[model samples]
Target: MLKTSTTNVVPEKKVEAKQRQGFRLNANDKYYASIFLGPSLLVLTLFVFYPMLKTLYISLFLTNTLGNTTVFTGLDNYVKLISSPDFLSSMSVTLLYVVAVTVLTVSVGLLLANLASQKLPGIGIFRTLYSVTMGVSVAVAAIFWLFIFNPSTGFFALMSGWLNLPVVNWLTSPTNAMWAVIITTVWMNLGFTFLILLGAIQSVPSTLYEAADVEGASSRYQFFKITIPMISPTLFFVSTITIIGAFKSFGLIDLITKGGPTNATNMLVYRIYKDAFYSGNYAKSSTEAIILTVIIAFFTLIQFKFLEKKVNY
Candidate 1:
């Protein structure tokens, strides 16, 4: 009886050992996965997440110019930003640019994408040429446009006979500067809009077009009833990206206009830069920065809440 009981216990002990070893292997695998994932996640948290949270952290305080100490004041900075005329003006200009850029980019992109979707001759070449703008950096594009639209020493000067108009200062003039910024932004940003829309157009089902053809539906009618509905998600995404970009626009403004002519073209980002570096008001700069963040957050939330649901249609 003693010998039989010992033999039975040996098998049970072996089973327990095997189960413990299997659990150890699983834990080791999980530990390795975490180790491999650590670098990228740490970088993202430090560079991206940390800075964003830091901005919110700084927005509640006043930095002493002489003492270099930060003083907390709750929402006082926000209140000051709201009442300031410069802030109001900058906000208005920023909004205008965002709206105008979104409209122009989305409309032109959809039009180009629809045209390019057809089996037209030389489309491959045209698409490549049109997408060249995407490769051009914003600073370079702005400089190129400045040269192209130059009144006295540019391409416009050489082709003076085409239109009977005065040679205007493109960058210095407040009215023309704003318009110039818009034009440059549209040209540079159109490629992205086109690329996104093209992808969306391709994702649309061929069966729908075939069905429309079988029913003898006109091309215009099919596009309106089918293509538009299918590609709305793409449009919304591109619009949101474009608007956010317009708000964060500083390279072109800095390179092209320098926020001159009584700060006519000085949008919010420009104002923030100026306040921080040029005007030597770090506290106000932080306040303006937070205002910008809030504006973008509000708009983005609105878009996700309302427009996101309509994407499937």
Candidate 2:
């Protein structure tokens, strides 16, 4: 009996091993997987990771016009960037621009989203109108806004003449140029924000609103308590994207102000571009680029940590 039991168990173990072998990836499976994933990996390495690593490497040495490292400065490039008054001013302006754009874009987007979510006549038309700007490219939008902000032929100019009001230099004045950028950016970004928040708002169960209505909750109270909390995840996403976009704003500044009126509109990205391409200071530009990357990463991490706690999901 013992001999029979042992023989039976060996056969069962062999069968189980065969079953497990069937689940393992065969040669064909791995070949197909590689075929699908290889190109994407190659592209990412070539474009993203390689450039980042190269930038980090270049930040350590002063390079000549031909992109050859002439002197090993180590962290001296970073030190100088931090100490330079122009760099410091660019950082300050970048901070202000990021904050202004992020807040305005996200808030206005949520507002428009709330309005679009409402059940009303021609709401789809309104939604389409709001989202139309999303189809416009950044460069196109910047140029279009440039036409609008033109002191001679733009909307403001025409309005000022019609109303007999003083014509303000939208793109020229140091104090008002940043606002001009903000306004154009807000309009361009509103469509995306609206669509995202609108989807989030719509996903919220109407039963929650019904319950609130049964409890005599006011509209403002429902908005603050129900709408805000329920859509906090989408809000966080829009805010993060907006912040990053604001930091990397180049085409708008280039077309609208070109960091003019005494560098009032010069953000970090524009400054980096100017340093690298125009001024031929690759090391300094690389340092500034790395610094900007760190700043963006820090802010993103902070958002995920602090803002995430409030998110319902």
Best by TM-score: 2
Q: How well does model 1 score by local distance difference test?
A: 0.82
Consecutive 10-residue window with the lowest summed lDDT within model 1? 1-10
Off by over 4 Å in 1: 1-30, 157-162, 298-313
Residue-level lDDT of model 2, residues 1-313, one tens digit each, is 5445546567788676556665564656888989999999999999999999999999999899877788898999999989999889889988898898989898888888888898999999999999988988878888888887899999889999999999999888987899988888888898889999999999999999999999999988999999999998778888888888888899888888898778999999998899899989889899999998997898689777866676553
Clash number for model 2? 0
Alpha-carbon error at 101 in model 1, in Å?
Answer: 0.6
TM-score of model 1 relative to the true fold? 0.83
Per-model TM-score on C-alpha atoms? 0.83, 0.87
